[model samples]
Target: MKVNCPTCQSEVEWSAESPFRPFCSKRCQLIDLGEWAAEEKRIPAQATQEELERALPDIEEIEAMLAQQGDSFFRDH
Candidate 1:
């Protein structure tokens, strides 16, 4: 079997003889590692509940915002 290297798109044999099955050479493997380390490569994911909560405005901030808006914010029409 053969597979293309994730970094260089070079063909690599998928076997025990091929140390880096998904990468053509050590250079290609290192390049892919560097991309990941630099945050250039990322897996799509949803924010965790804790992360979402942390991003939301706290009670104090919400109150401050409401105070800044004043009574008109509550007035209908």
Candidate 2:
């Protein structure tokens, strides 16, 4: 199989013999790594403080709920 390099978009062979399977060469691979290190590449996400607070249950609430449920929930059949 053949695929494009993530950094240079160059054609690359997908095989064990190809040292850099996803990248055309070490240079392209390093370039992608550098982009990540420099914060140039990022995963899109938006979460306000209020949104996060609402999304996650409080630790105490989680503990209480787990206590109510007991260890039976985790027991293997």
Best by TM-score: 2
> TM-score for model 2?
0.46
Tens-place lDDT digits, model 1, residues 1-77: 89977755667899977776677655444434433333533312343334424433343444444456573532212
> Across residues 7-45, which tens digit of lDDT does each residue of candidate 2 receive?
556678999766776877654544443433335333123
Q: What is the TM-score of each candidate against the true structure?
A: 0.45, 0.46
* Clashing residue pairs in candidate 1 (N, C-alpha, C atoms within 3 angstroms): none
Best lDDT goes to which candidate?
2
Residue 26 alpha-carbon offset, candidate 2, angstroms = 0.6
